[model samples]
Target: MTTPIVAFLFLLLPVASLAAGPGGVPLRSAEVDITDQASLQRGARLFVNYCLSCHSARYMRYSQMGKGLGLTDDQVQDNLMFAADKIAQPMDVAMSLGDAKRWFGNPPPDLSVVARSRGADWLYTYMLTFYKDDDPARPYGVNNLVFKDVGMPDVLWELRGIQVPVYGEAGDAHGAETAAIADLALQTPGLRTPAEFSRDMRDLVNFLVFVGEPAQAKRHRVGLWVLAFIILFFIVSYALYREYWKDVH
Candidate 1:
């Protein structure tokens, strides 16, 4: 049993390494709270306005999202139900797969479970790290620190502003000198300040986390009740055992 457990632990090492952020870059903490309804509302707005154009959340319905986020049916219908006529319909894209492939080289992936698969940290870092690139060959004139050679353009550029990479010298393989991105600098300011943009991104990540598990909050509540009942049962059982054993002793 010990040997089998040791072997299993070794097997998990590669999986842990593979979970590291892209290019071995450290991921920033999303610090998202799924219980924050206001943040989820903001994130929902951002997702619908930007991501829904290309990507679809097929597992998530407008009615479900509205109920989870404390939104009214009217609000959801008026603001979020763009691609669907009915509130019960799933959040989907208007862009066809063929058109998406032609434009983006691949169909944009469905985002219903993206938060679960990619993790909140990766998504947050990816959203924040897009910088201006002069590479003419690349479809998007932007690159990301988290995802190098990324195919998608920075859709939130208007809000986050144009950023450029600050390079520094680094030793590459074979002891050769190479330029590496040391940091990012804002080349042009956008409508929102850096602080405000960060806050909005947090909200967006928060919403994605909620979408990944809409019942998580309720589940937590149920879990607390279960634990409480278990504790109560244990106490009563112990009392009964003491009462019976006292007479026997």
Candidate 2:
């Protein structure tokens, strides 16, 4: 019992670590709903349009994604198959690893299981936290509150627009006056309103969560059936046992 408890605690360690953003900032709620097929469809479109250029979801095949998202084969081929020729092909990028490494300093990591490794809240916060910084050293001229000095540019900038950090005075360890980011202000509005952008991000995160475990919904349904069967079997077994022992009694 103690061993099982210890193992369970160990498993929770990673989850606990993921709760905080950079500088121990608490992560915002993602509010993802994997069961929302319409949201998943919108997210799939967003992913293909924006994220697919840099990242690959190679663990998942186009055909599989289509089936999971309730998209037909033709729709997948016409819309989401920009990088792949066949529907059965995985969501691989056209860019080579060497090119990606040279361009981005490091190759963008595959996002097939990113939602599992990094929780939906983390991803959602990271997406919304990017703010403009005029630091010449930074490649993208942008930084994230969740991940400072992030290499990846804000791909959704066109939709979310330019945001600048508002700073406030704070005391450091040595009691010296210092500046800290108090909040983010949108310097320029984008194609989508803040509310719309947030909704889009939630949808994207939802789809990513689905991608992490495509069979999760099915698994849940199956588990419920299994539990029901066990209950029914126990009732029948107990009734038979009582009936057999009645003569002896």
Candidate 3:
């Protein structure tokens, strides 16, 4: 019990310790739960729908996802198997690297290990903070608070709605302009409320975390069993030692 609790805390610390990026955009805690299968499933659906068109999780396979997320082959094949021909196929896109680069001005990065590279909190905040841009270069552009002038548009705009940045004057008598987001104000109402959208983002991030290290939940389960075996062996060995000592005495 204590071991699991300790393991859980260790899992959370990376998110807990995340700091804001440049432009003073703070990170929101992701609070990803690898054990929440339902949440992960919802997140998987969201990822496949919104992100899979552009991004690829090349290292992750549909078959591996079924095992990791406790889905049956049929469930995975029917629901999550979009671009992959076989269940064992990796999560790659139909779009080639050259096409993606031409379209987006740069190739979209593979997301297989992104959660490990950029902590979950960063992803969570970035997902939530995309706003309709005011920059002249991309006046209709959708920019991210965390990564300014982000290439990817607001893919979840319909679900979470359009957010516009709330700016404030800072650090000068003449009031210099800055891209820093003081707060986010939803410009258009979406299918889900802000609270609901936050939960959806949480689920999406949770799935990413699960994909980043599919064995994490399994490791936790196996660790408990391993500890139990060790304890039982120790007790049996102690009893045998006591019996041998009794005969000697």
lDDT of 3 by residue, 1-249 (tens): 357546644664434544566666678999999999999999999999899999998878998888878999999999988888799889999999889888888688989878876879999998998888766796348888787778887889999998888875544666655534578898899999999999999999999988889545565699789777866776677679878899788
Q: TM-scores across all candidates?
A: 0.78, 0.79, 0.76
For model 2, the superposed segments whose C-alpha errors exceed 4 Å read 1-18, 173-175, 215-249
Q: Global lDDT of each model?
A: 0.86, 0.87, 0.84
- The per-prediction CA RMSD against the true structure, in angstroms, equals 8.8, 8.0, 8.7
- Candidate 2 is scored at a TM of 0.79
Q: In candidate 3, residue 135 scores what lDDT? A: 68
- Higher-scoring candidate on lDDT, 1 or 3: 1
User: Where is the poorest 10-residue window by lDDT in model 2?
Assistant: 9-18
Q: In candidate 2, how many Å is residue 151 off?
A: 0.5
Q: Rank the candidates by TM-score, best first.
A: 2, 1, 3
Candidate 1 residue-wise lDDT, 93-174, digit = tens: 9999999999999679988878877889899999999999998977889999988888898999999999999987788778
lDDT of 2 by residue, 128-236 (tens): 9999989999898999998888899888999999999998777888998777888899999999999999999999999899888954556568977976686567667
The alpha-carbon lDDT assigned to residue 229 of candidate 2 equals 82
